[model samples]
Target: MLDLRVFENRELAQRILMAITREAEMIGREVRLMHVCGTHEDTVTRSGIRSLLPENIKIVSGPGCPVCITPVEDIVKMQEIMRKAREEGEEIILTTFGDMYKIPTPRGSFSDLKGEGYDIRIVYSIYDTYKLARENPDKLVVHFSPGFETTTAPAAGMLEAVAAEGMENFKIYSVHRLTPPAVEALVKQGTNFDGLIDPGHVSTIIGVKGWEYITTEYGVPQVIAGFEPVDFLMGVLLLLRMIRKGETRIENEYTRAVRYEGNLKAQELIGRFFEVRDAKWRALGVIPTSGLELREEWKELDIRNIYRVGVPKLPDLEKGCLCGAVLRGLALPTDCKLFGKECTPRHPVGPCMVSYEGTCSIFYKYGALF
Candidate 1:
């Protein structure tokens, strides 16, 4: 059996830290590295990895959190559905991840709607939403699916199962998106990060090969890393080494779970039910081929088709919320004026402070040491 303790070994962490220092010193310039994973940020901040690293070496965050990237328009659409349901005296049950429940939209949050006697619920999985649909045949159950590749696979599997059964009461509002396009958009928009620490969880589904475009196209190297401190440090080391060597390629540090080709079965399952299209991200606007839509065959279960919901012409973010800059690697969570005082977990001013995977939330939970 593998010893889980090995990853957290203090002595090993020191050795990695020393190597990082040496690499950063050899690089002899300001090296800005960005990791597109909220868990990576948590590990970096919680482990005080930044405090240990050379001052010249900076680690920034990208648009990694699925909840952070989920467009406010999607929430508005759900709100419209709820309003129409109540007006028409229809029982419409809306289900989504717990993090999404507290996200503030122009029409307030799902929690607010629930308080007003709406059938909005916090579900752990698509399976839970399915169970709710099965139990309540009279109500229209809508699963507000929002995630990257990691969560999309399971949602696709559930969609397949639901379609096979021809479940009429069940519907899905898919805000599922692809990570690569968003990453590419950052590069195109000039975020100014040297290397990337690719998200380990997302890479497990999209595969190590999924990040090759970053190197081949933008000439930026990336390393796929796990959640552990050692894994994150090692990823930084590998990326720095690659940069020092003047090489651009995608490296995998989390090999135990991720593969070159990725989970083919999961990919196939997703392809059958969803198609790639331009998607509207919370901060990034619309990115081509970044969002997933249900295939024509599966359109019968798509909420967007059955229900017409108008998202108000509103700013993507709330007043004084710096989540957009934070997600784009242009600013840190601490840079936000509303980070600590006005925006705590209890009261979130933006989606970034709401999701566990959001950079702002991670930084709030684990104070930035650097």
Candidate 2:
């Protein structure tokens, strides 16, 4: 039988934490490291790593959760597509990952649309949408492609597959945002986090070199980290070392998956079909070249064109919603009055509480509200 003790290596964890603490103290400065991955935030909070760290060492959560950053307008636009198709007496199938179903918009969610007699299916992969398109050529199958670089690779591959097969029924409503531009926007806004623990999965596709501009221009150190406790601790250690030595560079702690240059074929596929454009994040307003749109060459495959629809402009939220501040790292979940009591995960008034990777969801799951 496998020993459980192997997984519960508390002594090693303590040593790593102590080493980071010691190194941070030697520098005579507070080490404020921002983790740019929601999974890392959840892991650190659940493991009580924040309590274990020195008082001077702080970890702030960045805009790493894709769902939290997705603008309300995109959700509104998706609902409009569904409503339009139903009025024309045509079958419109909306497919996306399960997490997106519960994400609320100014109108409602895919779940709400499904309740109103819309054919919205929760698909595990984009390939599933392609298969459905092949089987039901008569129906309009629109896949909601809302994600960052980590998911864009597979979504790009699916587009390629659809193109190769010449499937006209399948369409992708893309709200895919890139990572490097978002990070650059944060830096340009004069945000003052000392270092960044870059996203591991995103780094796997875009690589460590993707953050070169942040280091060269903003003089901030970045380390791509894995999801493990040791990996996070080591990332902190490396960032502290960089700050102490007065060096700003990009490092990859999760070297197993990421390299200096990422997957070339995946990048090529994304370049072939998508072009960068200004996008409005839910919290952060419009950031130039932060979003990906389907290229003009592939306009025929674009759902927005086929449906003759455009993304709508949504007004600000109702009172007592600080989702924008939270996503910008200006506030935490606990800072909001409606965090735990009024805005629990079960009945989320904001998008941050709806998705599993959201900061509010992380706090709710790990009992951080109290």
Candidate 3:
């Protein structure tokens, strides 16, 4: 375990809050800050950090939760693909992380499909899927991979390993995305947030320098941050400092883990197996080059290509489901009419309620403050 002592001290936290309060007061305007990671949302909310922020300073959730942002149409498309494979007399096993298994779609969840004996398996990581593929060579193993750059790296690495070893039976259905393009979309759409409290896990993979364009183009400051309560407070303080000075640049509050160039080895692995393509965001729609796809050289390993299924068309949002607004930072979890009434963590109607790191789930657990 990490012995990061200063971060845990209540006195230090109080002092940081004071500094943030001072900064917010000096600015004397509504300071809109967006934290673009689900883990960060959990930290800010679960720790009651949002409740502690100055009334004038609002911290909002962004396009962070991977599962929450996974378009319902994509989930539906995967369900159809798995069903089709079964109908075609192919013994197939669909593997994905646990968070994805319960994300509802028009066709219900993969869990529902599993209950019907469709062979949906929840694996911890891509490597585990690889092992499963190896053990059951008789069945077609389709790994349903999803997440941001950090999770994408390992999935890509596994695909590379499959290519090297010629694992013909293994394929990947990639829902992995890059964070930069999403940030750009928010800026282009005029989010008007004072600064970004960036995700540390994503920054650890893509590095601090990857966010340079957001500052250069949008004049918005971003502070890379860790998952701890103290890390979040420090990130906000750094942002406040930037906003007060009328500066727009990338700052690294998560210095202990994030580096200038990020994890090059992971980048290399990602580059080797995947390429940037125009991919869909559930709420944001298609942001050009925001999503990752298998390279042409490895197209045979793409589940879409192998199954002759095109990119799923985006569907209309469920009636009264404010998940779209929530993901875009346009609204809060409590703002949705269905939040606590029709939707809860136990019986989630939307993807946002299903994932542990999702804003709706976080808010449901911690209650909304802003």
In terms of lDDT, the poorest run of 10 residues in model 1 is 361-370
Which prediction has more favorable TM-score, 1 or 3? 1
Q: Write the per-residue lDDT of candidate 1 for residues 1-370, one digit (tens) a residue.
A: 7787888999998999899999999999999999887778888888888888899999899888898888877787788888887787887899999998888887788888889888888899999999999999888999999999999999999988888888999999999999999999999898999999998889999898888988898898889998899999999899999999998888899988999999999999999999999988997898889999999988889987877767766678889999999999999999988998999888999889999988888888876463
The superposed Cα distance between candidate 2 and the true structure at residue 14, in angstroms, equals: 1.4
Give the residue spans of candidate 1 off by over 4 A. Answer: 368-370
Please give the range of 10 consecutive residues that has the lowest summed lDDT in model 3: 308-317
Candidate 1 matches the true fold with a TM-score of: 0.97
lDDT of 2 by residue, 189-241 (tens): 87668999988889888888887888898888989988877778878889998
Highest TM-score: give the candidate number: 1
Q: Candidate 3: lDDT of 273?
A: 85
Tens digit of per-residue lDDT, candidate 3, span 1-370: 6689777678999999999999999999998899889999888887888789899989888889888788777777788787778778886789998989998876688899899888898988989999998998887899888999989988878887898899889998889999989989988987768899889999999998888888888888989999988999999999999999988888898889999999999999999888998988887788988988888888899888866644445553668988888888889988899999899988887778889878899889876442
Which portions of model 2 miss their true places by more than 4 Å? Answer: 1-8, 310-312, 368-370
Find the number of clashing residue pairs for candidate 2. 0
**True lDDT of residue 319, candidate 2:** 71
lDDT of each: 0.89, 0.83, 0.86
Which pairs clash in model 2?
A: none
